[model samples]
Target: MAGLQRELTLRFLAEPADVNFGGKVHGGAVMKWIDLAGYACAAAWSGKYCITAYAGGIRFVQPIHVGNIVEVSAKVIYTGRSSMHLGVDVKAGDPKESTRSLTTHCVLVMVAVDSNGKPTEIPEWVPTSEIDIEMRDSAIRLMDMRKKIGAEMEAHIHP
Candidate 1:
């Protein structure tokens, strides 16, 4: 696996439409944001269009309540021939109350595919800074989590 500093970070103001009956942002909505950020990070890192091949280890660590501003950050961690590992984290804050917490975190695996939907080689990952090391470690851990979850999912399907 290689490394790249490509990332996408976005801030969104939580609204009623983003939350559920429990008054927290819907898990699916969080996942949608993760997917978008992950894919965009991968595409930017590889300089090619990318599609998500898998999502795993999606954990809701805290609840993002309505009226909070949520910040999402994502980046590419690992790259194979045509595949990448992405990490996404969601944090919630209030402009007035000064509260910030990690609401969710997820691991995304994406593949670079050509116009014909065939997998294509990714660009070379060049890491020249300390931040790259942290990203590499994060990617490794995220990949391990993905593998474990994938195994469990497979067992559920096959068993």
Candidate 2:
């Protein structure tokens, strides 16, 4: 791994179709982009076809306007058997400057399945550097948050 590989990058110019009446990009549009980017990242790392099994915390802190271009990037965080966690970051940029500001971040858990739709094992994640370690740690925290959120939802829905 001398050459660091980019998993997936999607640039979307905030269009009227992709925005709300307020002229800001719709949350769902951002989700669609994140889903594609995350799936691609997981598939590249797993070296197999993948499906998103779960979506973690997605916070849209700032509104991206119609003229701004949003770019999404992702990388694999952890893997266990058929499950892989992919970290995604979304940034808003201006055409004048390719530089982007991080606007959203989340973790997506995906599963690799076989032709029969059964879960399939994938290569384990290996942290080669400090950045890798931080990625894994962040994934772990996100995973725990997902569990907590599930518990909260269950308390409201089932209890």
Candidate 3:
């Protein structure tokens, strides 16, 4: 199956209510938007309900101010038997401005689920474009790093 639909972009205006005491948009708010965009992309690709299994490397590069126009983009970069890995990027800038700066980025792992909440396999996605291939390869490399990190973390925990 063609997987070109496994990408999504969402845009919203950051209002006063979205800002913290510092007058910058809250990190949690941006994270919520990221999750929503990732979920939408995964669901569209899998054609099934999905749940976020993990979110890694969340980096807030810049603060998003109130009244800034926010854009969240999510794309499927890799997939397992039942899980889809997504790369999400968030950007914000003045609505009238021609340029937007990246505010945050993260990778999310989402697993397709059935009505019983059990993980289910979805169609495999093969990268057709040069950019898609590059992204998929990057995701594979990151997944290897994630595994090593998880192993180290587990070794230190004695629970």
Candidate 4:
């Protein structure tokens, strides 16, 4: 299905309300945007309602100022029977300037669900280009790392 339309981008102007006391956009606002973009990508790819199962590795690289042109891009880099893993990037730049710097990045896992809210099978995404392959591989590496971390956490919590 031609990579299954695996990417989605959302762009808008950062509002004054998005800023914190320090006058920069709050981290929580950016996270909300990431979730929104991730949900859109997952739903488009799966053709079903999706819910986030995991969101981690959120890194805030820089602060975003209000009135900046903000862009959040979400791409489905890997998929399983019911889960789509997305890499989301957030960037912002002065409206008068052409350059945009990355402000945040994270990986999210979203699961497609049926009317009963149970996980359901969805279409798979296949990498088609070199960049796509690289992105997919990166997502797989992150997945492996997450599993290791989860095991460690379980051990620490129970033992």
Candidate with top lDDT is 4
Model 4 is weakest, by summed lDDT over 10 consecutive residues, at 1-10
Which residues of candidate 1, in runs, are more than 4 Å off?
1-5, 97-99, 127-131, 134-159
Q: What lDDT score goes with residue 56 in model 4? A: 96
- Regions of model 4 farther than 4 Å from truth: 1-3
lDDT of 3 at 113: 96
Instruction: Tell me model 1's lDDT, rounded to 2 decimals.
Output: 0.81
> For model 1, how does the per-residue alpha-carbon lDDT over 18-118 read when each residue is reduced to its tens digit?
88888788988889888888877888788778899988878999888888888889877667789987778988889576767899988788999889989
What does candidate 4's lDDT look like per residue over 10-36, in tens digits?
999999999998999999999999999
CA lDDT, every model vs. true structure: 0.81, 0.81, 0.92, 0.93
TM-score of each: 0.80, 0.86, 0.93, 0.94
Model 3: residues with Cα > 4 Å off, grouped in runs: 1-4
Deviation of model 1 at 42, angstroms = 1.2
- How accurate locally is residue 31 in candidate 1, as Cα lDDT from 0 to 100? 90
The TM-score that candidate 3 achieves is: 0.93
| Candidate with more favorable, higher lDDT: 2 or 3 | 3
Candidate achieving the largest TM-score = 4
Error of 2 at 121 (Å): 0.8
Order of quality (TM-score): 4, 3, 2, 1
Writing each residue's lDDT as its tens digit, candidate 2 over 1-159 gives 211343678877877788787878888888998999987787777777789899877878788878898889988777777888888899997968968898888888989888888888887777878998888888888778888988999989988
